[model samples]
Target chain A: MMKIFGKVAAIVAGSALVATAAFAEDRKSYPAPKDHPLSEIISGYEFRTPETRALQDDDFENPAYILLDLGAELWSTADGAAGKSCASCHGDAAESMKGIGASFPKWSKERNKAITVEQQINICREEQMQADTWKWTKDPNMLGMTIFVKNQSRGMPIVLDNSPEMETVRKLGEEVYYTRYGQLDMSCANCHEDYYGNYIRADMLSQGQINGFPTYRLKWNGVGSTHRRFKGCMKNIRANPFKPQGEEFTALEAYMMYRAVGLPIETPSVRN
Target chain B: MRFAALVLSGVFMASVASAEEIKKVEIVDGAVQASLTGKPGDAVAGAKVFKGRRAGNCLACHGNKDMSGEQFHGETGPIMDGVADRYSTEQLRAIVVNSKKVFGDHTLMPAFYEVDRLSRVAKKFEGKTVLSAQQVEDVVAYLLTLKE
Candidate 1:
């Protein structure tokens, strides 16, 4: 009985020590090697299930191809008062849009911010195509067009330009990535950086790469933009998500793409 | 090792005694002595909380031998096979209440009942713990059954 009480006393004492220690908030920075900065990056694509990878490899088998086909149709159809199609200004997307998506989320002087491909699409619709901008969230035309444009750049490496003018915005993106938020007190880095290879249940976490924006997720059952996926992640941690195409999400997209430099663009990539 | 340093430190008894004074649960020496029913918890109900998404979400980062058939079991943290042999009931209770109490504050596992030291918490959830005292007990009860 004396030994039993002694064990209980030790257990109680250990619990107390844990409760009172100062909580450490040690944040880790990017472990980029000076010689080969891009070598450290790992795309979530490498971690996808074989079935999902196979679906992405075959265009005919990929459900996202449906959206890609629709986008091709929308590219030729004239719209708005000008009756100008996207093909009108830039003939044959294969020739005009080869490496365009690879350098997206670029700094736009007129907009005074980093703009995603979706925003650029809207800008073209208003100025060039003269059609009303597609809806921001879950618009079939938007997703289709996005996949169509991004698909052209498939196998091309992501290479967003980091101009001096865009440094502040890029820094803001980094801040957002590292900042812990929500009731769970988790930052994007907590999962994508620190626990990159660990499983958060059955789902193996990749580095939260956005090289495959407008991805076709089995869970989503439809194509979703980078902003759409970011909103979903925020909601998962019980945080109030910002507007889908808002400044915050666009900034996050820009930062994500920057982190994914050198990763081959895999638009409409399949994921579980 | 940090774990060895902590064990050797004299602060264990001092911290546990202070925590017991503030919380609803009792602490003996260094272990938690919490009991929702003043009896052993129901294992069946405990399993539900263990796998709940909004509650414990243990499966989010823990693989369990008993739950091998369940989809999406994680492997970030140590697996739960034979966990009953590894930790005492009181030690398990303390971990369920606040994992930092056993592991440390930097662990990915959230403190299911700790209401303090968290940032950016939604206004509606302010001062509210992640799990009820009963749920903590239930989870502890469920973990105790995971024998090798």
Candidate 2:
């Protein structure tokens, strides 16, 4: 009787351990907020054509790697009046920048506002390295470096700012996302939220998730930033676009990052 | 030479006047009671405008069962099948001309003939309506053909 009881106890303990492990794994995979509107948070990757998806799967086949290589070079090369490269302060980005990309659009106490990864890079250049800031978007050097840094956090889940300081900015972003603009009289929610899987002409609309930005678009024939894509969308609606480095886009980025929480970073990702 | 100069100025002024004449529309009881062009619309031309990307591009939002041969009908707005059964020609004209005036601000449909009071219109597209008054009439005529 004692031996039978011992065996049953061991079985129960084993099953409980397995259940706990499974729960932890699930949390790690999908750390989405409980109140999120989407029942399932799908990555933009799922919406891409098989060929585009395949390009992202293979590092060599992916055209974004060309830019990433340039970014790697820039990481070690010294520039500006300070005569310092990024490596001078932070050595071996592989170790320091790991998971850095996944955690961005964070609140900056100094700036008194939420800042994106690109903004932070410029800030570091000005304050730390005494260098001139790069253009907000479409600059090849800026694109390469940004993609490189972001690539370090590839496959890591996105982390967003939920602090009290970010509350107003996030609200503003939500408002902008829902507000109708331009001659077309359409909001971001009209297509991205309401009809994500549906086609607007030949193009299939995704949820407009930002986890895969600085994405490699076949249309652009190169890598581009989230803000550039935002500008493109605005133009498509016949609206004059806001600047990439402007406050409106920054707030939008913060809100978008919040929406994309827990999705894996896929910087330099291939898209059509 | 003086006569020729006068004729040239007159011709230029006439062209400008015609360009400015976009046709004033008044909404009465959720419909535009009069024709915009004061002429009958061509349904065939309206169909072409409906399909052309540079023209109405209506298929981008509204699905049409008759246009099944055309790819990628959007679901953002209602399927345009049997749209004629629901609305009259005047009501359709009002909706096509300026949907916001008829359906309020909540509708996603763009005002095809409204050009003023729009925010952040691209420099190139400023003061330009998405569709001409005649085109709107044509689109309305085509829409009227979509019976149950």
Candidate 3:
């Protein structure tokens, strides 16, 4: 599914930045669109009108909605060898899990790392839910279920804990946010921080809030979760993507979400 | 007589059940919740968060750089109108998290879920992420209030 142009463009852009950076610091240059249509803002969060903020949503029978159903069914079904459903242990997801989605990428003392909400689900599934860990981007059941599980806490304000015990995880996340990475040699701060208000191509820069996500897009033709957005950012940076349940990701999730701090949630937004 | 009684009961029962479903939506976290207020969304908050540098910070892109006046709306994306009527809050949340899942070949969108799906450092970021699920929801809550 890797587009040929995407690779060609990435290589062209990656080396170009390096070449330009080594020679053009006194010049102050704009980085070229060497990879994946370089953008300052992800179109999803852009505020468009009802008609222009297009979506495949008008189609209720669209296959996309099925993902939600799959998620709903998976919500209550048992998965563990002990035959425990997410509901069995969580005790009616609606009640016990109220506002749970809005508090994730938490630090785990037991694991000595930050854990994304999805990883939390994955761990529960493997240890508590007893189901096999989902494959990266392939298992609809897991993906759909994760989206639905996350959607449950849509309106809640972000309320992650920051105990003294979680100090290490927070520090690690902070490191990642500031550390420079990827072929472009840009850190999260490079675009989202230092040059936040600048232009990448035709688009404007944004401070990048995680509040409105799993958004409906005319481009993808359906709603997608936050993890999918994470994947794209990595790809844009030209870094090899990690597995869905990898450790570093959990920490980064902690950093990104926590940095967002008091922003309101945007669970299933529509985007152009 | 029997038909009339049955129809009346069905209507009464349906109304009772529908009312119960509405109760599950949490809106009383005080004025901060934004569900029960003037207009669909608190345009004031939308204006503040949307324009603030660290909050929603929407003014970064769509509109002119000047954060002055109601008309300094974004241009890259369409100007904000009645967003509540456009889509329910849930629909908006998914888009904010990951537009790629919905919009194919869209140059402007990225995935917010995998947090650090990209390995920023060789092995250091192998299991990293970009944002957490809760952040996605909170933004969604704020967006729903963007109605007239």
lDDT tens digits by residue: candidate 2, A1-272: 23532453465446545643443343323446898755456677777788989999999999999999999999999988999999999899989999888977778998898888899889989988899999989888889999999999998988766688787788888887888778887888877875665567878777788888898999998889999999999989989888896888888888888788889998889989
lDDT-best of 2 and 3: 2
lDDT of 3 by residue, A153-238 (tens): 86566666777645566567568666555532346665664433344433344455565555555656666655566666666565
Each prediction's TM-score versus the true structure: 0.78, 0.84, 0.50
> Which of 1 and 2 is the better model by lDDT?
2
lDDT of 3 at A134: 72
List the lowest-lDDT window of 10 residues for candidate 1 chain A.
Answer: A20-29
Best by TM-score: 2
Which model scores highest in DockQ?
Answer: 1
Over 4 Å off, model 2:
A1-32, B1-24, B101-104
Q: Sort by TM-score, best first.
A: 2, 1, 3
Report fnat in order of the candidates: 0.58, 0.62, 0.12
Q: Score the docking of each candidate (DockQ).
A: 0.27, 0.24, 0.06
Which is superior by DockQ, 2 or 3?
Answer: 2
Model 1 earns a TM-score of 0.78
All candidates: TM-score of chain A: 0.85, 0.87, 0.69
